[model samples]
Target: MYHYDEYDRALVFERVAQFRDQVQRFTAGELSEEEFLPLRLQNGLYLQKHAYMLRVAIPYGTLGARQMRTLASIARDYDRGYGHFTTRQNIQFNWVELAQVPDILQRLAEVDMHAIQTSGNCVRNITTEAFAGVAADEIIDPRPLAEILRQWSTINPEFLFLPRKFKIAICSARQDRAAIMMHDIGLYLYRDGRQQMRLRVMVGGGLGRTPILGLQIREGLPWEHLLSYVEAILRVYNRHGRRDNKYKARIKILVKALGIEAFAREVEQEWQHIKDGPAQLTEAEFQRVAEGFAPPRYAAQPDGDLDYGTHLAMDRSFARWVSRNVQPHKVAGYASVVLSTKPGPAAPPGDLTAEQMDNVADWSEHFGFGEIRIAHEQNLILPDVRKADLYPLWRLACEQGLGTANIGLLTDIIACPGGDFCALANAKSIPIAQAIQSRFDDLDYLHDLGELSLNISGCINACGHHHIGNIGILGVDKNGSEWYQVTLGGAQGKASALGKVIGPSFSAAEIPRVIEQIVATYCAYRELDEPFVDTVARVGLEPFKERVYARQPEVSTCAM
Candidate 1:
């Protein structure tokens, strides 16, 4: 966790005072709704269906125990007694008073956190792999670099109000947990043959109206040129990216229209100016950022009688959870635990009560390092749990409804806060997701349908990441009724691919059945131990499309 310096403190103090004035003006008649829109949005305040929603950034999804406690307090004092963890690893309070936003931000600032770039057209949170510092397969920790970007991009003067929102992600690990390829700017850090660290840059990956897996434009960019390279790419996009139509404004559209070669050339031409500028990080600065994130001194040996096998023998459910949710840590005896936010049929994907947040904080402090990681898949990670305390921690999570045995299983769904909360939505997405969850309630059945990413969006804005799901369900409107279109074989991460629609959209009522047909087709055709996504890629979408769209004249074929 990066601590706030005096500079950070002073800047946030000034910004909060500044926003307080803006809010007063807007509340008075000095600013109209039209005039206040961008201003409020810049402050992470959005006018939603019934109230304002405030999304606070949790940088790189890392939260200290105290920061977690502050968030819990905010939920209890400011909004309703809950907070929703976003897919980007941020937290959003769906019901907030616009007037109180500045106060909330001030509190966040006190904790060295703010919502500065979590909203508006500026670059959003710079996410890294949740396992950044602790992953066993990592070449280096990416969090310090992520922090650098966060500081540089926060309230940057030139880049605000860009063509559309930009996302940047970095993965230091060999396994791509960050979903870096699905970002506007994705960086892969690796050590070259000389044992020198470098970055591989990918640009224009996003999931929206036109989903695109980013193109790798530059390889082995040395560590010194990172900030300059980012500045160059952003400047190019800010200058030439689309703004005429909202749908065509993302960098993905620009990359698609200009082609990767041309876009890369444009960025290179700009990079010439700032490649060796003052902003290039020196050894001291990098050390300052890196010092805050050193791994905690762990016990040399186990304090408890170490026997997870005994717990597994006592509880099969606990065994299943440990096998699925636990992950490897860099430390010898420490493990990272994935706390499933995706639980049952009707439960919201990432919503957690204040009590639950506090409990997580307590558990993090009690058993593991007082740090938490929010994953891109709408789950929480206790990144430094002792190998001996897995069962007790699992028990606490179970009591709080945080223990869902499904991690990569079919029941672990990624969905957006659609019509239920979002004003931009055309139809309800949460209910549709709930229906799908209920449709496949059997854990054994869902597990058998292994590693399926079922992403649902209420509408085409694709907030629920419908573009990248192995099975995507997108909502549409037809004669005042909501309908859905299913897409097969979309993926995000190292081997990234966007899903393709099977056919014409099905009515909302007919969607689950359509999905069932597609799944059945998969189950029938898949080789032993093959996942749904693997089976789809191997067999193509023809057989499933044919089964799902049978007897429907309106359905049309689309390629994956």
Candidate 2:
């Protein structure tokens, strides 16, 4: 929701012009592919298996209605009719033309959007919770600080090229919807007894070949030191992080090699050098960035609305949707509505057609403020929908295929494009996700099963964030064939933990049935009203593994 000032506009326009020339040079063969590689990557362009994929950044996952429409136009005009919303809260166009990229950048610039720092080994998009300011249980709004981080890091010559991609996430809510624990740097924003803002800093968290939760490096850090502390961590990483091996380049690996104590000492030493430097955030700057995210005007309404209660009582389907997809808001008589992008086999998880995008943009204005949010779980959000507008909005959303009642259920899976679009993928993730969704189409059953997450990744890159799902499925390569590996008890949020692998990898055809057995095993052993993850924690992985492998055919040994 932060509108670009003249400086921001000039920076984006200049970048577009520079990239246009670079693109022209490459097209004319004046620049070699090797020369163009980093240039293109810095601009959020990737050469995938079939075509170039363009990833556009949605700063802190906030989007104005106009920006959403612009994205829809790009999807319609430039690539295929649809775009994939990634777990990072960014959207990817899988089939983009090499020549039209500059034009696309220009279009994005018109709406204060760009792809800068989205793909390069730089600080990627600074993400926060989708329900940042509006969540009922929020301690303090994190978007202002998130925006500050974004501005400070964008194109900072000191950190233009790091050993590997770095990600940072901040959250202020009681529930961690942003999955901050799995980021390179995670910040929990809160207020102390005196209402002085503070941060709990975590570092060295990442998911790839090696998945590890972040270790808390600092607690009760004053809000003024947010940027300074982050810079100190980056300086430490830039100096000591491995550059010889890509697999070992992430800060997580560095933190692992050096124990947390040593890592903390190094960061502390680095911070002492820059603690009071220009990077330290100031009150004036904080207020300037925060003005853009100030609360929207609202009409005073009662705690309960008669029409809303009437609709919920009359329509069971609407009630089910409200139960699963709606969230409490900070303001009375309002709620945050999650528009699920996962709609079973009709579309892949995290994908929306141009038409759907346009519809959402329209609905955003009609229902609430002209704002939309992209969730880390690959869903769209209307953060301030009035309770009185719930029924009409739900009807409109249902008409556009955006109303799926499975928010944290099995079918509401988080998945990457996998082998279908990404060359780095060893196996196909889309089909597997579709297969699982198709198998678990019963909404009643899913709701009864309680909140569960199923995440899939095509490879070890963990693009789908499979390691943190309640039931994680990873695609593995076995003798040039694709095999699926299952991990149980993974979870995100406050008690985030990485999943443990079951015995062996199963063939693609066996994934659905394997998931079925896992679910059945959970149902058998679960205590009354226990969530899937809690059941896994109570019963452990042995029972699910026993049931899955008991009646299965011979399978290859675990390779991952």
Candidate 3:
């Protein structure tokens, strides 16, 4: 994990002081709600359903044991006893007091963390693969690059107020876990024929009302020019991206309006000027930042028989979890463990209690190295858990209400705190998740179905990542009633693409049934042992859509 130096320390302290004054003004009525909106948002404070929510950043999904402990402590002391890890690898503390925000931020800063640039339109969070350093397939660690971009984008004077929120992701691995293709700027680290590190840049990919896949402008650019290249793209977007309509504001729209060829030309022209400029990262700076992410030394254990083959031969539940939750690591006998926040019978997805947070920290220290990573899939990642000790860890986790063993199953849903919490939501999404969970309770059925991501958001902000879900559900208010618009076949990977809507919107009551029908459709068409994503991709949405909408009650219809 990268520790905050003096400059980082000063910046956060000063920002908190500024925000405290702003909050005081708002509380005292010196500043109107309208005036305080942007300021509060910039500080990662959101006035939600019943109370305020404070989102804190975990840069590039990296956190030390001490920082993890601090987070648990803050969750225990300030608000609830747990925090919801987000798709951007950040954590949010709901039910926070409006007056205590500055104090909470100060506590976070004490542990070398803050919420700056976690919100507002300026580059929300520079995310990367959670398993950056330890992944066996990585060409170069993306954290240092993510940090460099984070520094450059953090309240940059030029991009403070973009038309809409901007997201950037870097993937250094052979198989992209970062979901880089669905971001404002997606960087794929690659080694060229010359054996030098470079990036395959994808620009303007996002998911909202109009989901757009990014257009690749630069391919195989030298690694030294990463920041300068990114800046070139941002400058072009900042100059020309729409500010008129909120729905049409993302760079995706701009890229679409201008064809990929034209957009590439524009970026090329911009890069010609900035490619070798001062913003271009120097070798020393890159090395300095890279050093911060060097893997911690572990006492070499005996390379003995730590076989999970015996366990796989026995416990079915353990095997299932191991299949979905474990990732290959560079170090032998070590594994990257994904602690799923999604639980069965539809407990609130991504909602963690303060106790759970504390337990997570304890478990991390006891089981693995004192390190934690948060995945972009709204789950916690213990970067280095030993394979041999997983049973004890799983048992302890089950006790603390942390074990679910439903990592990639249908019950593992990604739902926004919709109309229940968010003021902007039109429908209640949590109950829908509950409904689906109850309907789909059979683990055998789920396991058979395999690796389906169902996401629900109140609206098109795609906060729940509905756009990227294998089964994406969006809530809409149809004549003062809540209805869901579902999308199918979307995926988040190296070949990432947005899901397409499956026919008309379904009433609140019909969502679970529609999902059931969709699942059934997949079941009918799937080849032997094929995942739902693969089945859907092989067989288009028409088969699923027809089955889902066959018996729907009277409703208006339009092309999906």
Winner on TM-score (1 vs 2): 2
What C-alpha lDDT do the candidate models reach, one value each?
0.86, 0.93, 0.83
Clash statistics: count for each candidate: 0, 0, 4
Q: Compared to the true structure, candidate 3 yields what TM-score?
A: 0.94
Reference-based lDDT, residue 142, model 2: 96
Candidate order by TM-score, decreasing, is 2, 1, 3
What is the Cα-based lDDT of residue 461 in candidate 3? 76
Q: Clashing pairs in model 1?
A: none
Which runs of model 1 end up more than 4 angstroms from their true locations? 302-306, 550-560
- Mark the regions of model 3 whose C-alpha exceeds 4 Å error after superposition: 303-312, 552-560
lDDT of 1 by residue, 1-560 (tens): 67778987888788888889989998898999999888878777888999999989898999988899899999999988989988899999998888788889989988888887678999999999888899999999999889889889988898998999999999888789888888999999999999998999999888877777888999999987889999999999999988898889999999999999999999999999888898687778888988888878888755444487688888888988887889988887788999988777636888888998999999999988789999988899999988888889999999998888889877788888888999888888888877777777777666556677888888888888988888998888888877888899987767777898888998877776777787788777888877677888899989987788787523321111
RMSD of every prediction: 3.3, 3.3, 3.7
lDDT, candidate 2, 36-74, per-residue tens: 999999999999999999999998999999999999999
